[model samples]
Each structure stands twice: as C-alpha cells, then as structure tokens.
Target: MSIRQPVSVKFILTEQTKQQILTEQRRQIEQLTAEMDQIEQQGKLALEQAMTQGGSAAQEVRQQIEQERNQRMEQREQLIQQIQQIQQIQQLELGTELQNMTVETMVDVNVGDDWGMVLMGSEIIIKDGIVHEIRRGGQPV
Candidate 1:
C-alpha cells in the first residue's frame, strides 16, 4: 500500500478512425448498388431477347399451362359423371330387385303416398310393375 499502481485502460477508436470506417461503409454500399443495377439491366436485356425471338417459348409455356388446366377440368368432369352414372345404375338395380320380391298384401298402400309401405320389407311398391317405393326389412305393409 506504499506505491500507487496505474490502472490499465482499453484503447477506443478516435473520431478520425470512426469517420474512415463510415467512408468505407459508404463506398461498399455504392459498389453493391452499382452491381445490383448492372444485374437488373442484364435481366431486362434477357427478357428483351426472349420477346424478340418470335416469343414462341413464352407462348408454348402458356399453352402448356392452359392445356394442363383443361385436362384437369376434363378429368374432374369425367369423374363426376362416372360417379353419377354409378349411382344411377345402383339405384336402378336395387329398384329392380325390390320390385321382384313378393309382398303378403298390398293393403293400406297407395300408388305414391304411403310412408308405411315405403318402409316395409324388401319390396318395391309397384302400381303396374312401375316402381313407386323402395323398402327394406319389415316395418308395415
């Protein structure tokens, strides 16, 4: 505790050094801006060339996109039609089979207005062999 010791200190950038660093950063930013401008110009030139050369490439790509869209739409329509056709066929087949089954009596049954007849047995209620109702199991006939 007799002699005092000097405290160690870290060096910091002076104002001149800070100014130099800022100048370098500005120079780098200007260089990058110039490069970006050059790249954009090159892209524009390429697009111009593509446009001048008959423009067939772009047209072909557009046609391909349109064709693919049409194909998908056609496929979707076909699928929907197929589903509808299958449903119709199933309904017709079931109705035919139901009409072939015999019922004990056709009492309390109307040609087209009997909910009880429509829910009873595996019978397709036919006025004259024309299907009026489709039924399953035995509820009421």
Candidate 2:
C-alpha cells in the first residue's frame, strides 16, 4: 500500500534568498499601509453618510470600522516583526538551513516494513532556489 507523508523543504540561506525574503516582506508592509489608509478614508465617508440616520447607526459603523482597523494593525505588526527576523537571518553565516515549507510525498508501505523507517519522512535541501540535496533516514540520498 502507498500512503502520503509530509516532507520538510528547507532552504540553505544565501544572500539571494535573504534579499528575496526582505523584498517580499517589505512589499507586504507597503500593501498593508495603503489598505489602512484607504480604510480610514472610507470609514470617514461612511460616518458622514450614517450621521443623518441616527446616533446609533453611526455608532455601529464606527465600531465596525474600529474592528477592521484593529485587525489590520495586528497584521501589520506581525509583518514588521517578520522583517526584523529576516534581518537577523541576514546576520547568520551563509549556508545555514532555514525551514521553508512542507510538502507531501508518497511512500510505499509493505507488510513487515519497519514502521519507524517507513515514516521517518524526508527533507529536500535547496540552495539558490535550486534543489541541492535530498535526505531520508538522516542520510543523503
């Protein structure tokens, strides 16, 4: 029988990869800031439109806008922290491994197979956006 298993995909950190990460993270921060600004403008317009309805209606709109603002703020903070972390990664020596993502692979499981070895999982080491090596059972394959 064959079953799906998760394999670890790791990156061997290089200057190129670091810069790519930093660039992507900074882009996200810019996008978040723009969204926050647009939200504020829309909220102000909404408040003006709701004012004629009644106090309660405007209050509800205010609350909803506040909630949206809070969520976006939290997301922006998280991105900032990630940017800091990437900066720290920049300080690390080249070729250090970083966990990139997980992917599933199919493995053949036969009767009497050593379950531990069967489920040991695998890892693909990437360098400069290329697959450098693969390991299974902690040994290069």
Best by lDDT: 2
> Model 1, 139: alpha-carbon shift in Å?
99
lDDT assessment of candidate 1:
0.45
lDDT per residue, candidate 2, 1-141, as tens digits? 999999999999998999999999999999999999999999999999999899999999999899999999999999999999998999999989999999999988899988887778889999988999999866799
TM-score of each predicted structure versus truth: 0.30, 0.91
- In the range 35-117, model 1's lDDT, one tens digit per residue, is 55554566556556666776786565555545555654565565556555544544442223221234353333445655553
Error of 2 at 81 (Å): 1.1
Counting clashing residue pairs in each candidate, in order, gives 1, 0
Against the true structure, what is every candidate's RMSD? 38.1, 1.5
lDDT of 1 at 110: 49
